[model samples]
Target: MSEAQNPNATLSVAILSGKGGVGKTNLALNLSYALFRAGHRILLMDFDVGLANVDVLLGLSPEKNLQDLFRPDVTAEEVVLAVEPGGFDFLPAASGVPEMLEMDDDMREVLFHKLNKVFGSYDYLMLDLGAGISQTILSVAAMSQLRVLVVTPEPTSLTDSYAVIKVLHTQYGITDFHIIVNQVEGPADTQATFTRLSTACNHFLGFEPILLGGVRSDPALPAAVRRQIPLLRHAPRSPAAQDIVNGAVKLHRVRQQRQQALVDAPVLGKIPIIRK
Candidate 1:
C-alpha cells in the first residue's frame, strides 16, 4: 500500500544527534510518552539499529525486531511492541547485531515500504536514530518529514552537531531543522547555547535551525533511566519531563502552522480566456 492511499496523515520525526551520551534516546522515549499523553496516537521506532536501547529503557524483552522483517513470513506489525501504561507502540531494533547495520538500497527501500504500510494509523511516528551521521542515519533522516538534532551544552557536542547539520544541508539539501538543547543548566544557558549554534549555522551553513527549546539537567531524569522507565512516567513533575511535554506541544503547533500555510497557498495554472 502507498502512503497516499492511507486516509490518515502521519507526521514522521527523526530524533538524531551528532554524538552519543547526549541523552538523545532518553528525550525520544519521554517525548513519545508526552505526545501520547496529549491524546495523539504515537509510534516510536528504535532506528538506532545495532545500538537499539528502547526495549532496555522500557524493560521489555521483545522476541521480534527489525531482523524479523528480513524473514519471508514476518510482517511489520509482528515486529512492533506496545509499551504498557504509556500505550504507545514501538518497533525495536536488534542491538550488537553486525548484519543489521548494513543495508543495501534494495533492503532499505523494502524496510521503508514496510514502515509506510504500517505507520498510516499513527498520528506521529518518532524515530530514535543512532548518534552520528552514517549511511543508515542519512537514509532515515531523508525519509522523515522533520529532523530534530538533539545537542547538549558541551563544546564537543556543539561542534559535532554543527558537522551533522552541515552534511545534511550541503549534501542532502535539508535546510529546515528543529533543534533541542538537552542537559542544560538553566534557561539562560539554553538560550545562550541556542544562540551560539544558530549564529554559527547562519554564518557558515547559511540556514538557521529552529529552536524547539531545551531540556534542563534534571536529576530525576537519570534516576528514572536507572529505574528502566520513561521520565514522564517515573517523575511526571520533574523539570526534564515537563520540558519534553512542552517541546511536544511546540512541535504540534509548528506542524499545524506548516499544514495551514500549505492549505492557504495559492494554486498555479494558466489563466482561462473568455469569449464574447
Candidate 2:
C-alpha cells in the first residue's frame, strides 16, 4: 500500500503453498474480499490452471474462463468474471484443461501480456497460484511483486514450505517473502510453528521471512465453503473471518505506509515495493 503502489502501479501478490489442501484458496478469496471492502480495486486470478477452484469456492459457473483467453480471437476482458458489489474481478483458470499445467515459456509470456493489459485498471492483482512448486507455478511466483506462502502446523507442511523457499531462492534469487500460519490451534502453536520456520530459513536459507500472522481452525470456514460464499461475507463474526480481515488490514496498512515512504523519500534504500 506504499505510495509506489498508487494508481500508476498495481501491487500484485501471489498466494501460494508447497502443499495442497491447506486452505490457500480459502484465505486468498476472503483476503481479496477484505481488500475490496476496504475500497481497493482488485483483480483476482486463479492460477491453479487446470485444477482451478476459486470459481467453485464462490459457487460460480463462468461460461468463459482462462482457456477462452487462448482462443484465436478472444480478448482477456471477454473471459474475466466480475464479482459484483465488491469491486473485484477474476480471471478463472480452466478446470480439466491439462494443458494449463504444461504451458511453455511462449504461452506463459502470452498469458502475462494479456493479464498485464487487463490488470492496468485495478489497484491490486491477487493471484491464487496453484499448489506445488512446478515450473509454471514457480515462474508465476518469480514474476509476482509479493509472495504470501501459506502452511499448516504439520511437519510435512513445514517441509514443503521450506522446499518452496529453497526453490525460490535458488531459481529466482528472491529473499523478501511472507508466511501465514493457518489452522493454528492456539497462539502457542502458531508461535512454535513460526519459530520452526524462521529457524529453518535462517539456518538453511540464510534469510528471514516475515510472519504475517495466523488463522485459527474454525468450522465456519468449511461451512462457508459449503455455502459457496466467502467467510467474510457468510460468517463475518467467526474467528477465521476475523483473522483474515485483520490480516488484510495489516497488509493494507503496510502497503499504505510503504506508499507514503516512497512519496516522501523518493528512493528509500533498497526495500523493494511489491509491484509488477
Candidate 3:
C-alpha cells in the first residue's frame, strides 16, 4: 500500500470504544474479515482482557490464549488461532482470566515481545481494545499507527466517546482519530451524529476527526451474533455486513494514504511498539 512498501511493514490499528456494549468487538472482527477477504493477511487480538469474548462470538474454545504465551512451553504462534469462515488469525484471551484482568507493566512488555515476532507475517493487525480510557488501553493505543473510535447515536455514548478523545489528545498527544457511527437507522441521522461529535472535537480538541462510515441498524446482525456466526459469514448480504465492508474499504484507503505519506516523509517511520 505504500510506495513499494517495506517488506516487514505491518500497519496496526486499534479498534476501541468509549463504553462497552456498543458492538466494538463485532465491528473489529467483521472488518478484519472484510480486509482479509480482500486478500490482506490480517491478525486480530482480543485485547479486552478479562472480558474477552471474540472467541465466544465465533464459538471457539481455544487451546491457548494470550495467557498461554507466558507459559514456558507455549510460544506466541502456538497461542494464535486460525479463525474459520473469516480466514484470519486471532489471538484470543478468554473471559474471567484473572491474570489478564490485572496485567502489570512487565506483563505488557512481555506480551508485546512474544507477539512481535509474528507481526511481520501479516499486513495488518487489529487490536480489539477494552472499552473506556484505561491506562492499559491508552498505552497500547498510543503505540498503534491509527485508532478508530466506534460510537452510537445514544447521548451517553457520545459523551463518553468525547471523554476518550479528550484524554487521548490531552494526555497522549493523539489528535488524529477515525470515527465509525454504528447502529445507524439512516444516513441523514448518522451524518447528524457524526457532525455533532466532530463539532465538539474540532471546537474543543482543535482537530476534526475523519468519518470512515456508518453501520446500519440491522436485526440480522444480532441474529447472526446470537447464532455464533459472523455477520459476513452468516448473512453476507445483510445491510450491516455491507456497511462493515464499506467501512473496511475506507479504512484500507486511509492506511494507503498514511503509507504513502511515510514514504515521502523520512521521519514518519513505523511507530515501534515492540522495542526491547
- Give per-residue CA lDDT, model 2, range 1-276, as digits (tens): 542244445667789998998999999999999989888888888989857999999989888887777776888988888996556888888877787887887787666666666675676788999888887788778777678999999999999999998888877788878888999987788889989998999998899898888999999998999999999999999998888988898877666655543333311022223333
* lDDT-sorted candidate list, best first: 3, 1, 2
lDDT of each: 0.82, 0.81, 0.83
lDDT of model 2 at position 190: 81
Q: TM-score for model 1? A: 0.90
Q: Give the per-residue lDDT digits (tens) of candidate 3, residues 1-276.
A: 532134355678899999988999999999998988897878898999869999888898898888888876878988888985444899997677766765677887777777877876676889999999877777777778789999999998999999998988887788889999999998887899999999999999899989999999999989888998789988999999999999999988887777755333322133334322
Model 3 ranges off by over 4 Å: 1-7, 85-87, 260-276
Residue 44, candidate 3: how far off, in angstroms? Answer: 1.0
* Per-prediction TM-score: 0.90, 0.90, 0.90
Clashing pairs in 1: none
What TM-score does candidate 3 reach? 0.90
RMSD of each: 7.6, 4.6, 3.9
lDDT of each residue in 176-257, candidate 1, tens digit only: 7999999998889899998998999999978899999999999998898899999998999988888899999999887676
Q: Candidate 1 clash total?
A: 0
